[model samples]
Target chain A: MDVFAFFNLNELAFGLSKLPMFPYFDMAHYIISVMSLREQPGALCVSQRSPLACWFSSMLYCFGGAVLSALMLADAPVAPLSNTTNLLLATLMWYLVFYCPLDVVYSLASLLPLRLVLTAMKEVTRTWKVLSGVSQAGSKYSDALFVMVAVGWAKGAGGGLISNFEQLVRGVWKPETNELLKMSYPTKVTLLGAVVFSLQQCRYLPIQTHHLTFIYTLFTVTNKTRMMLLGSSSHPLSSLESFLYK
Target chain B: MDVFAFFNLNELAFGLSKLPMFPYFDMAHYIISVMSLREQPGALCVSQRSPLACWFSSMLYCFGGAVLSALMLADAPVAPLSNTTNLLLATLMWYLVFYCPLDVVYSLASLLPLRLVLTAMKEVTRTWKVLSGVSQAGSKYSDALFVMVAVGWAKGAGGGLISNFEQLVRGVWKPETNELLKMSYPTKVTLLGAVVFSLQQCRYLPIQTHHLTFIYTLFTVTNKTRMMLLGSSSHPLSSLESFLYK
Candidate 1:
């Protein structure tokens, strides 16, 4: 038996592809939404906030990406909100994370082990969304690399891109906090992944989706693990970024 | 559609039961093992430790439950270590969590979102193991409720029970820090859960596995959430304990 075969990236990617991903994605997204909402300077404290306001803001943040993608591709803003079960689950998760007594859900969700898994799952979903967006746009434009990359980027980081809009919906205005000014690692990676995926779709690159998935997974996992371990103050990829830009 | 049916516990349990469990259990258990090992007063700092000693102690802590359970039931100490894949994965996780440069894995694993999910998975696995132990003992002993509960307790909390032995293996003997003197929430809950499961197995309680799973999950999720939110200093169930005892 070949020892190297046991660590095959293709095989690993195949196994990962088989796992049910949506639940992990939804949970991770909701957690991120709650965290982001809490970070908003204009947001009211949980104790002082109205339940309706909380639900509205959280739902907006949680479904921002899907809504944005739908609008970009289908010209329909309400497409993502049509699913009743998805809406209910999102609201339930948001409520639990933000309004649950003693803030138990938020506290537990913030723990390292759970956070690491959620972050990994979220990245996996981002990869999937980016590819899906590229394919969707390719079907329409069929050779417009720029459009495909733009759509893919939107699908992957639409939520972050729309943070200012989301905050506006919550009656807060912070134009300076727009994602473009302070691009997150996820947003940056998504843009880069979008470009590569777009190139592949246009026959400029010859990589398989699973191969890309494997590479993206490896990259995100290493970076996320480092970020979690080193504390948020220490940039996990700063050294790599410096070397690349230098 | 009846809105109440949407929140059915049985349906929820069935859904949860269908999800892949072992991966979550294994990951959660490894995180817990890494944490407990780090807490040991006799253990050397990661930077000061030999790789071999670290591997030995971590593997021992990680597999202590299975090894102890095998001794109690199958009378074979090495039965659990027979699988090379399980051993390799365990060692890999142990190495990453404990010995990874910059403590990245440990930091990532400690994050709340990931920790919450892992802890929930751990409790779910605990409930399963407790029931399994009760059923296994009942099949052999036929009418020994005490024996069933004892085996169940051992199965659920065996890792903690053998911590002193694990420490001794690491060249650190601290009889005072035994699990009996400092019973953690999981250990206490496991014992209680074991007794209840034993009763159910003996036909004394008119409940099913899924029902117990639902209840156990609810209980632990609530308690764990509270514990996480209130910080470790706040005893989540202390108020309830006082009320019940009084």
Candidate 2:
């Protein structure tokens, strides 16, 4: 019974609307972003800062905050919510949940180890790029790799909805189902993002890339199948992959 | 008339399947990935390559390939032509179009400089990370920024499909519409992915971060709203936003 409850997205998502202290959460995030800290450079380490880096870094924080703020407001009182608000909120959530995690854990305080949110939050922090500049190709390639996974997941999710819009419509119409759909899809995206990054990171482990690819393809197959066969299938890839597997 | 055709997803996506030769393309990408280029690693240039870095590098190629393969197989000999395949293909398409461009252009050479695809692919290449060693915290923080944009995009697309399932279902049932859906969603995802990246990259431009955030949140509101109002919203945020916008 306990285990079963954990698997239920609906039950799990029900409490999300009542998330506590979002202002605090956002505030903590803001303070962390505004203050810039530099580590002592080693003899081996070089210090190169882009003049325009400030603009890039600042807006990221603001936009990210905007997104988290939107999510926090999800349970708040945005009177006369517009279709536009919902879309922006959704877009922001997708972006934040998937990529924000790469930097989240570093900023989160130890005192507020909230378990309820940890499932989603841990992912935000779990991936930390061990910083060592290999080359421009290396850095750009890393960015490219991240883009691939995020895009791959997007592709899967988008297609799933297109083919099965009826189920989505039904879920959206139902309160708990709708909320679960909203929360779960991002969770799935976050998970997929992490998975892709990790798989890429695994290459650092010495396994041949093609071998890893085979395993990844299999994992992609299995993981996707599981999403379709088991859960409500928030994403297109999961549902579709599972559908194909069957 | 030609201009209008150029804008058409169907017209553009038509030749994607018969790509002259994938092996050569992959070979070109491998060379590019291996060759390290420099932009301007002035302030701090750091080079740290974990032995494991290679593993991470190789798998991305495979995963990206896997996704493309799965998408390519959508219309192939996967018997029964089930719903799951359709869903997976759609999701993959969404993910691919949005994010695949970054890697696509470098590998795609002169033959298929297809105008529309180039617009998106060029953005992918334009936003390269000028890599040098930053301190661990610095690199990690930068990683964090990247995470935010990626996750936001994922959330937008996932939610888009879920809310607009009916249109999706109808699209899936029809070949032209389905093809357009498959092609267009990825294009949207790529465009969004690139946009998020460019905004993040603006940090390199030497502007004050706060001014950037103020401008950013406003831009976020407008850009998201614009996305919602125009086009066949492939992203949840767009459709939902448009729904509320209307």
Candidate 3:
């Protein structure tokens, strides 16, 4: 009997996708943007920064997923500031993360139990974006494998790809800081996933989207958990490589 | 015009209630259990602790809200170990928190961004438990305001109330560590909320359940945010009192 016969990957993927991950992903994106801006030299402090600049920087990061996917597919660039509720919530989250009195929100967010869930959910969000991007591109370019991969890759790692622009919007110029020079594990994994998805889309691989989702989710959750546990942002398997090679 | 006329708080409450908070709450409770066990002296470390004791202790915390509410309402003591999925997930979490090599899971959880979301969601879970407990008791004894309050209080602070028992299950009892003598701010707030909910049930207060939920959410979020920011587990308003009285 096939081991895979007992479990249905599609149903599992469907259930996982039903989770309320959008808000968590949105918040995670905003937090990353704010943190990235803060990390830049000569960037104004949260209190000193103009609200418009801060808001613009945040909008860029928070909506980068959608905007970049559209751009990758050569469609009209969807305006990032479309939803009022999303905008309001993002602004509130930005304020809380940076300006909450005594930095309480930041400290609470730093706790382990909460952090683990957010990180896990954020990965789930990335997987969803990558999958959607692949399908979206596939619909437009049915015969173009390269186009499908590129679109998915763009959707998955768009935030990083656009970091220079995001930073410029905040009046911080650091062209030296390119995502290409130091691609994050998530971005690399997304590229690989895009290729796999594109292959599957072109009938070169025999697997369902849900199957791919399950695989991606498993890989990411394990990788993230390992990264988080080791307290290292480096590749999750780097320790193994170091141990084996040394 | 009344400021309240501008908003449909009930709809807001309904929307908030729809959030996938159960899983987050369940995980938060399990994390707290493991943390509490770790904090005790003479207790075996996670790796050393018997799996039975760990599971039992975690189950007590994870299912405390539901079980305590049932008990308070004079219902049969619900079996905590009924759900296989929840049990399996709790076990996995327990292992991850305790036995993950290098304590990486714990470290990731210690981060600010993720922690804040978890803490906020946990408070939302608490507010939900209190409301449900109030209604559960109210149904059985419609005119019994005291019963409603008691049930709500138990549901809200049942984990603390049963902490001693939980520790005892781990073979590390500490009678001096009574919850009442050192009541947490959450417990105090829950007590106040219980009274308000009970009053509302008894028709002495003019407010809907959603209205109370809105108030509770606002109060807890602000209070927890303050506490987390100050890095003090003390009451959120204590600083205000010190400033005023000083």
Alpha-carbon local distance difference test for all models: 0.71, 0.31, 0.69
Each prediction's number of clashing residue pairs: 21, 74, 15
Question: Which wins on DockQ, candidate 1 or candidate 2?
Answer: 2
lDDT of 3 by residue, B1-246 (tens): 133347755667657766665576767756655655555564445236355456556667766666677655545333333354666677777777767899987777767766666677677777877888888888888889888998999988787778876665555546786878777777778888888888988889987666767777888877887788888877855676579979
- Candidate 1 residues B1-246, lDDT tens each? 133256665577767656565665776776767666776775656425566777777777777656665555544568667877767777778778767899898788788887777776666777777777777777766756765776788777877877766666667655434455445777778878888888888889887766676677678767777787667734545666669646
Score candidate 1 by lDDT: 0.71
TM-score of each: 0.47, 0.22, 0.46
Encode model 1's per-residue lDDT on A73-94: one tens digit a residue.
6544433444556676787887
Docking class of 3: incorrect
Per-candidate DockQ versus the true complex? 0.01, 0.02, 0.01
TM-score for candidate 3, please give it: 0.46
Candidate 2 residue lDDT tens string, B143-244: 554443443333223222222322221121222443235435433543354344435443554543333323333343344344435634445556764698
Which candidate comes out best when scored by TM-score? 1
Residue B91's lDDT in candidate 2 = 36
Give, for candidate 2 chain A, the lowest lDDT window spanning 10 residues.
A128-137
